[model samples]
Target: MQSTRKVTEDIRWVGCNDRRLALFENLFPIPRGVSYNSYLIMDEKVTLMDTVDASVTHQFIENLDYTLEGRSIDYLVIQHMEPDHCANIEELMRRYPNMEVVANQKTMQMIGQFFDISTEGRTVLVKEGDELNTGSHTLRFLMAPMVHWPEVMVTYDEKDKVLFSADAFGTFGALNGNIFNDEIDFEKDWLWDARRYYANIVGKYGLQVQALLKKATALDIRMICSLHGPIWRTDLSYFIDKYDKWSKYEPEDQEVAIIYGSIYGNTEQAVNALALRLAEKGVKNISVYDVSTVHVSDLIAEIFRCSHLVFACSTYNGGIYPPMENLLADMKALSVKKRTVAVMDNGTWAPSAGKQMIKMLEEMKDMTILDMQLSIKSTLKQERAEELAAFAQQIVDAM
Candidate 1:
């Protein structure tokens, strides 16, 4: 049977949700699953936006078939060539033999590299600012290279004022029959996965995202139809503001997040004490996490969300703790920046994790490492109460 939803009077959603996939891109865990959003425009010339992942190819085709209602597809617009969105390209070509593939030079090159498809006479080459007229709806393509991929571009539907934002504003999580952002409590429920998706998947491409945002400012977009998660049909600025802040490496909240790596619980003890002290200083909503237990992707997401961070780790085998080191490496690799950080290290004889963490933070952009550092020998003692109080006080003062 066909499963689909209406986005407007003429456009229909032909996407499929996958809740069985444990991981996104085989990297980040998607506990709530994900959606591969493809749209169909029912104009004089039938147009399909994109295709879903191979895992949901059958469902996607069914949705397309129902939406078409015996009308032949005229064009298949290739937005991003990432395997997840382009998995059914060859299959679709075989299904719609007369349908033309609309994409840029780079996308065409990639299609050839990924599949053995003959695009000799069935390709509609487009570039930035190029328009395709399909009766009432006119689509203007805008180049958004490196937003996630080199061949990426977004289409602007002039009539409905909808921006087909490929993966630019997409998030992880399947739409549980709720297609639009306003249909759910996005801030409370979906924002966590959304932040994680952006921080881990597209976080490294902040500069490219900023460039895309700049181009979007010129267009009069009423709805944003992304390739994942929910569509933005209302309060578009709420999501747009988040994208702007995230792309600029700005914090969404002025809160503190404490991540610690404990070998035998001593370092975790110090982290607990510090967290309590910071909370006592009137800091609410402080997050505490065991770096060894939590996924590094989740840690990266928390770091991106919080304005302040505290890394507590124990030295091991004359080096920083392995778990904490992994978290720092992932953070650096994802281009995390613009946060105030405090360091704490525990060791029986020599503590180097704090110093090593400070060095790593220095490599990132605009990171403010606190001058006050805490070192613990085996376990924190009541004798060092003054020092701990002073360290916590410094964090409070900074905030």
Candidate 2:
């Protein structure tokens, strides 16, 4: 019935996991599913942090109702007004007739845009540095505009030292009954999904995230209660450092990732050759992905994780391959920069993809494209072995 976990003595994680949904935001695939976390703070006022998606309304309401024990919700704080977290606002209001919606002005406007309910008298409008005292715990609202959303704000509990991070430190996986980060092997199991989630969802707003991180540095936060993924109660710096590096567009590892767009496996063969060359040159942890087979979100996450990148593609219809072009467009859209890149192209006639890919990469900030461009006609011939060796040497030297 009520599938919930206790976050602290007063806060209960009344959230729901959606394993049936194939995609997150109908874009990225979520094989591990995702969690829509909504926390309920049991104080004298009985405040609810946020609401879950409509898809899980039944489970969410069951958990909320069981945790409330028939007590009414005095306040419903809206951290981020995104549909996934705000879908049940109207339903919540109907269930608890006197519950006041707590949010910033922009969130209030969005609430009006999304729902038909009247917020004339049943709204608590908060601003930056505003505090709400719900009996024992005091929640201080911090405005984090453009941190993925313009109206986003994070709440800090003064008593328990918990930060109700809206979506800042979130990941893309179900809780699996282990709601806390320390309960599971986070670094081994959850880091990749977390990277994918941040790189795709919040990668575009690095400056805003940096600002939020700056604000968080001043507060003595002991726990992070995000609206998705597990709660962080121990070793906070390990995750915070990751957020810091990700928000700054820094590579997580000094490694090479070779991504290829191959139509008939020709370009893929060339990528494999280059990866072998890199390995022979003492390069470790080299990652290779097929642009056509692998999801763009996964590629983007790899691009974010690796410091060095190799883009090998086969020219199609006298242009760059579709998958490779799409990946480059996504890289630009997400403001991906500050990395070293190498380009290789294969064509039966004219291999213009190498130059075109370089032009696209040049549009981004602080991208270092290697001068050793490897152009192959259909395949890597034996005569070009010397040239390939030289190209690999250039990359190793640059590293």
Best by lDDT: 2
Please list the residue runs of candidate 1 whose C-alpha ends up more than 4 Å from where it truly belongs after superposition: none
Write down the lDDT that model 1 would get.
Answer: 0.93
Clashes by residue pair, model 1: none
Name the weakest run of 10 consecutive residues (lDDT summed) in model 2.
264-273
lDDT of 2 by residue, 231-267 (tens): 9999999999999999899999999999999988888
Candidate 1: tens digits of C-alpha lDDT, residues 64-130 = 8888888889999999999999999999899988999999999999999999978999999999999
Local lDDT at 258 for model 2: 93
Question: Residue 83 in candidate 1 has what lDDT?
Answer: 92
| Cα-lDDT of candidate 2 | 0.95
